[model samples]
Target: MANDDGMTYADAPLRLGRSLDIATNRYQVSGAIRSVGANASLPTDTTDVLLETGLPAVDADEVTVGDQLRIGGQTVATVETINAHATRDPNQHRVLVGLTLATISDGDTTRFGVTPVRRGNTLSLATDEYELDGRIQRVGTLEPPGTPTIRTVTLEISEVREDFAETFHAGMTERADDETIARVTNVDVEPSTLITTGDDGSVNVVDHPINRDVTLTTDLQVREATTGTTFKGRSLQQGSTVVLDLGTTTIEATVVNADA
Candidate 1:
């Protein structure tokens, strides 16, 4: 992209635009993408991207670090920093954003199941020809002396990993046990703990007070009425006890007055 000055420079090389097919809700911006490993002495899987775009003076504060950017296709990047270039160049009034590529898959020892892929979670990077499934190893930002007011955001992204290699299946039922079942009274009372299902289908077992009533069902799963986080059970005896195990968390509730 060319700066405001008549003099042109080939600094920002890669195209940084929203991939409507991958992330329709992504913010529209333009810049370049570069691999951080270009200067690496060792191998790594990550890349840094620079986004220099015009923003309204009023909404400049809206953009901040930690904001996610859909770099290209399903590959999402995290904002590392936002440079206004006020001190470096007084003329070029644009946002020099720094971004680091996000990872395709992560590991969590406490929980299992394909690292919990949500609907909107990135699956792979899409290109005009094909898609890429890679990992981001490192990311950072830098600024060299220039007149066009260009900020270099470096990233060490590795595409060596095969596309769609890692795979996992949700086998939480195999981890279920009998201890997760318990009995509690079903009344117009609030429970100390609650479990809810996120829009992405991820289970959220947190401590929140919620009221419940006696709506007996033959096959009752451990569920938080407020969030709809249902945990499958083995021996779900409705009138006797409730069995619910969400893998990450478990709850046992028994009705003191079963008929009530």
Candidate 2:
């Protein structure tokens, strides 16, 4: 390996300003330069960026905190912490994390980058700006016996997508199982006024004076909008009001009469 600025690695690990060459990506040490985190929305410094791409299993050392970082050829930020796992799977061995990027790290730099490779991965962290620029160190590989690793294991928050369907489904095939389905029969959905009965057995207020009877619809669907699956409601309604019992939160819904 060749040095970036007239220097070479002899024996004892390495010091600041050394570069780590994993596959084709070069991690240059810039400790002499100040890093400014370019992240926001968060109120603290807690972001973890993992570089799980193009890294060799046997030749990639784990990352540490306070290391100025770069990934995917972009200056992401500084690493707040390094999660090391002594496992056979090189990918799971390390998880480069960037918990938060809101608070400044008592310096002046901005951004870190993460580049993923096939047989291995690179985990890097970044501050709100970039506080790990010149503070990056070359993460070396593990000692003998471990195969040079390669693969990509990166997880990022894509974005807040909208106007999508929400669904949750799990497929299961089983035998010798008793299946049961329950339904409510006495409940009727009719139009009625809502009244909260007072402790004295009297309603606190009759909000729906025109509603004589009520029907209730209390069904909840727990799922991600991006997915495709929903939970239908099973309610008991009398007129336009329905009685719902959802754990701790309870709400009363009135039926809207269509053109009768």
Candidate 3:
């Protein structure tokens, strides 16, 4: 049932972002977002963006508070809180999500872009503009009025460092490899093992020389030599071109190996 405005809670027309949680099955859904206010101390420093998406009665039951939402593969927020409001019709309800921005850490910087906000996820809240570039902070669900099923999602979002001009272009590329040994280092290898031969008059013993030429190829995850973050591994793929930025000159190389 729709309100006097003829807009039901299920009538979210805009599509929000995608799920940040890669483990969950990916899904696409339409929803609405609004900006309430920000921290008074630094209002512009951090902003709050709210999202409301509806689910079918059956599907609403499966929606959890911790669920993730994303747009364009960039995680917007986690389900902070959920609310289901019953309409005049008994069979339908609305799911309102109070989503906070995802905290844009250094690790998130690479995958999300120089700046977290994307044009696709922007929303017109009152007179100001807001974007989805936050993570879910807290969430919970509430019982719907009457018999309608309901869910509630909440979020606490932080602001992204402004860099609208940094949006991706057709030829824009991110340089991953850094030649600074100070930050990154060559893979450490184990010392060679050796076996000694038995002396002529001494007890007889077998001696074997370990293979030294064998290159160490590991299937383990590659982390930053400095921060131990998964930023590089997450962004770069095998065959991807990598440019190591050193203060003096840039070193270009190909990604020989990579994995999730």
Candidate 4:
């Protein structure tokens, strides 16, 4: 028998074997699981499972939090969050889905299904509720690895209102859900240059600067994840953009530097 994709049953074993090899080689660094099936069970004893997919950019938007995952008319899990990762193929982006599973059983498979959820194995899942074709990437607690630490990050705001920049001072904070996410420790503002191009294709900087370049040093909780250091759920790395809300105003700035 063959599936719509023209993949026959004979191809299953080869695909599964290849996926297992890929998973083993990339497990530690990539955190990718290519497939799962009956011969395997959950790698760890946990209710939280992380699924990975290489969904087309157009269809990726269909995944969201609170989406129900069902099999055979039985809802087995709920999507808690979605994280995207870039890949060499721009058309197909990789995504990680954090799932919270409810009680489920399939013979010896027990909580997950009839098969042991291994690192790499193709697992057929229902798509009636949420159209998803994912392989189990991880089976363990989804919480942050360890306690967060205070880190100082410097950001550069290319343009800002002069008045706002003057009034913005240290001790101001950005919060989410009433929890402080970042606190400004220092602020520096300077005249920003304006650039213009002539008809000859010559680039020039205007003599009179109209904008202010605001540099801010902020302290925030930085947590480590399997991927890397993260601040406010985003990759905390140089050249990344971060948005800070100071109650009265909001500012988006590019990270200039960060303390390791």
lDDT of each: 0.33, 0.29, 0.33, 0.66
Per-candidate total of colliding backbone pairs: 17, 103, 31, 10
Question: Candidate 3 residues 1-260, lDDT tens each?
Answer: 44465333345322223222223366534422322123212122222434444345455455556666565565555555554433333344344445444443332231122234432243311101222222322222221112211111111111212232122122222222122111222222222344445566555423223222111122222233343322222233455443332233233344445442
Please report the candidate that would top TM-score against the real structure. Answer: 4
Looking at model 2, residue 170 earns an lDDT score of 18
The residue pairs that clash in candidate 4, if any, are: 35-120, 35-121, 35-122, 36-121, 36-122, 38-115, 40-116, 41-116, 41-117, 42-117
Listed in order, each prediction's TM-score against the native is: 0.22, 0.18, 0.23, 0.49
Q: What C-alpha root-mean-square deviation, in Å, does candidate 3 show against the real structure?
A: 23.4
RMSD of each: 25.1, 21.0, 23.4, 11.8
Q: In model 1, which runs have C-alpha deviations exceeding 4 angstroms?
A: 1-44, 70-75, 85-93, 102-142, 145-260
- Candidate 4: C-alpha RMSD after superposition: 11.8
| Candidate 2 Cα misplacement greater than 4 A, ranges | 1-62, 70-75, 89-92, 99-260
Candidate 1, residues 1-260: lDDT per residue as tens digits?
34564222344332323122222365543423322223522222344544445444333445566665454444455557664322112232245555555433232211011222331222343323322232221123322112221111111111212221111112222121133122212212222346799999999876543322222212222323332222221121223343323233332344232211
CA lDDT of 260 in candidate 1?
A: 15
Could you give candidate 2's per-residue lDDT for residues 1-260 as a string of tens digits?
Answer: 24454323343234443444434244444232222133322223433333322223232243445655444564435545443222234332222233223232333322322232111333333433432221221222212112222111111111112111011011211111122111112223233335598888976755443333423212222122233221111121223332222212222334332111
- Model 1: weakest 10-residue lDDT segment is 149-158
Error of 3 at 85 (Å): 2.1
